[model samples]
Target: MRTALTEMLGVEHPLVGFNRSPAVVAAVTNAGGFGVLAASMYSPTELDAQLTWIEEQVGGRPYGVDLLVPEKFAVSDPDDLVASLRAQIPAEHFAFVDALLDEYGLPAHSAPRGEEDALDEIAAAINPAGAQALLDVTFSHRIAMVANALGPPPADLVSRAHADGVVVASLVGQRKHAVRQLEAGVDVLVAQGTEAGGHTGTVATTVLTPEVVEVADGRPVLAAGGIATGAQMAAALALGAAGVWCGSVWLSSEEDITPRPVKEKFLAAGSSDTLRSRTMTGKPARQLRSAWHDAWDRPDAPAPLPLPLQPMLAGRAWNRVHAAAAEGHPGATALDTYFIGQVVGGFTELRPAAEITREMVEDCTRRLRALGELADT
Candidate 1:
C-alpha cells in the first residue's frame, strides 16, 4: 500500500476514487484513499458548496477535484455564455432530440425542483471564461490535487497549482500524451485506457500503463480502466503503476448519486453490454447501450454535434429521461443510460464506499503476498 501516490497524497491506500457524489468522495477519503470529485458538470457556486460539504464530512482528509478543461471547445460569448452556446446548437438537432423522446413516449421534461440551472451548469464547465471562474473557486479551497482528462493542464493552471503547492495530475491514453503532460509539469499521470468510463481512448490498460510509466521519467503513474478488484489493482502495480484510479466501480457503491434506475441498469448489465458511442458527448465515451443510442444509429438520425454542444443537447434530453424513469415509465427506463466501464459486469451488489475501499486494499495485499509465496516455493 505504500507507493509514491500514497506518500504524495498522504493516504493509507494507493487508491484514487473518482466520482461526482460528495458522500462517496468523503467516504473514500475517510476510508484511507484519495477521493476526487468530478466537478465538470457543476456550476462554480455548486462546486464550492459541494467541496465545502466534503471538507466538513472528511474532517481534514485529503481529496482532489477533476475538471473537464478540454484544450478545444466551442467558443461562445462570455457575456452570455449559456445563451451563446445554446444558440450555436442547430435547430435540427433539437428537433431530433424531441422526436426521439416522443418516439420513446416520454412527456415534456421538467427540472425536478431546484435543478432549473442544469444547462447553465453544463455550459460553465466547458466554456473557457467559465472554467477560469471555476478554477478561481477551486484555488480558494483546501484541495490537495487537481486533474483533467482532455489534455495537458493549461500552463497557467499548472503555474497556479504549483504556486498553491497543489499536485497537478492528467489522464493519458498514449505515451505521447504522457510526454506532453510531463513537459507541462504535471506531478501525476493516470494511464486511463479505453475500458474506463466517460471520455477515453482505444488503448488497453495492460499495454498503456507500462508505456506511460516508461515515459514518465520517475513521476508517479496510476493505472486506470477495467480495474475494479484487488487482483486487478495488483496487476496494475505489477505493470509498473504506482496505484490505480477507479471511477466505474464506485457506481455500484451505495453512496454513489447516480439515479437508482441507472444503477439498476448498470447492475444487470454485462461487460459486453457497454460500447464506445459518440452520440453522447461527441467523443468516444463508454456507456451502457440503450435505446437512445439505438435511435442515434438509425439512418434518419442527425449526426451528433461537437464537444459542448453535444452535451448541452444531451443534458436536456437526459433530464427528461431521468424524470420519466423516476416515475417508473417503461419507455424512459429503457432509454436510461450513464457512463460506465467493462468492470460493471463484476458488480453483484451495492456496498458502502468504505467497505469497497477496505476490501480492495486488503484483497490486493493478500493476493500480492500469495504470489510472492508461490514464487518462493
Candidate 2:
C-alpha cells in the first residue's frame, strides 16, 4: 500500500484499474485505487467529456488516462481520414467479413450509422496529429498519469507530459522494451504478460515481472496480466512490483461496459478458454475463443492485416455482433467475443467497481501480512 505508485499518485492503495468506462474509473479512484480510462477508445471530444464526468464524480481525486501513443504509426492523409484508412483495407477482407457473417447465419454486416464511428477512434489513435489532439485534451485535465498502452511515448510527448507535471508510464513485455521506455523517460513500467487480454507478448507475468523489475533500476514497475485478486496482487508485490495494473478484472465489474452476453460467456470461461490471436488487432492479443476466432483460423481465411487496417475491418463486424447478441441471437452469441485473460475463469458474478477495489487492497494487505509473519517464523 505504501509503494511508489501510491506515493506518486497520492492514493491509499497502489492498485491501478484500467477500463474504458468513465463510471468504473471514477468508482475505483474514489475507492482509494487509481483508475485509468482507456483514452484511445474515444475521440478527443469524447475523451474530454468522459474525463470531465470522471472529475465530477471523483471531485478532483487522482486518476489517469491510458492511450495508444505509438512512436511509429502509419502515416496517412489528414483530409477525409476515415475514408483514407478504409481505402487501405483490401476489398478481399470486406468480402471475407461478409462471408463470415453469413456463414454464422447472421445478417450482412453494415457500418454503424451514428455521429461517433468506432473506425474514427481507430483513425485518431494511429494518426500522429490525432494522437497529439488526444494529448492536448489529456494535458488540459487534472490527470496524475498518462500511460502509453501500445509502446514507448514519443520524446516530445514525454517532455510535454513532464512539463505538465504528469507521470509518464508505458507497458512493456520484455526487458529490452523496458530499457527503451526508460531511455524514453518513462516514469512507470507495467510488465504485462501473455496471460493478459488485449495486445500482449509471449512471456508469462511471473517470468516477465521479475525480468522487468531487474532492469527497472528502482523506477516503479507495476505487474499486470492474470492479476485479479488480492492474493495475486500480493504475488505481484512479492515479485518486486510497486503495484499491480489490472484490466481483465474490471470486465467482471458491474460498471464495466462489456455486453451482458459477453459477461455471461466470461463467467463460464476457464483459465484455458483464452488464446492469443492476431485476428482482432493484427497484433497478438489474448481474447476468449469464439466462433470469430474459429472463422479466422480456417485455411482460406486471409492472414490478419497490421494494426489499423485489421481493427478498422473488424470493428464494424464486432458492432454488428454485439448488437445482435444483445437481443439473444444465437448466431451472434456464438460469434461474440472480447479481450479477456486467464483469470476470467475465476469470475462468478459482477460486483461494484469500488467493492472490487477495496476487496483487492484489503486482501492484498492481509496476504502480505501473513507472508511477513511466515518470513519472521
- Per-residue C-alpha lDDT of model 1 across residues 1-377, encoded as one tens digit per residue: 79999989899999999999999999999999999999988888999999999999999888999998888665557677667877888999999999989989999766664464567556546855567878888898999999988898899999999999899999998999999999999999999989988888999999999999999888899999999999999999999999999999999999999999999999999999899988888888999999998999999989988877788789888988987898899999999999999999999999999999999999999999998999989
Cα lDDT of model 2 by residue, 1-377, tens digit: 69988888899898999999999999999999999998886878989999999999998889999888666666577676777777788888999998998887787655546633656555446656678888899999999999987778888988988888899999998889999999999999999988999889999999999999999999999999989999999999999999999999999999999999999999999999999999888889999999999889999999998887788778878888998999999999999999998999999999999999999999999999999999878
Best candidate, lDDT-wise? Answer: 1
Off by over 4 Å in 1: 110-118
Q: Total clashing residue pairs per candidate?
A: 0, 0
Candidate 2 structure lDDT: 0.89
TM, every model: 0.97, 0.96
Q: What is the C-alpha lDDT of each candidate?
A: 0.90, 0.89
Off by over 4 Å in 2: 76-78, 110-118
RMSD of 2: 1.5
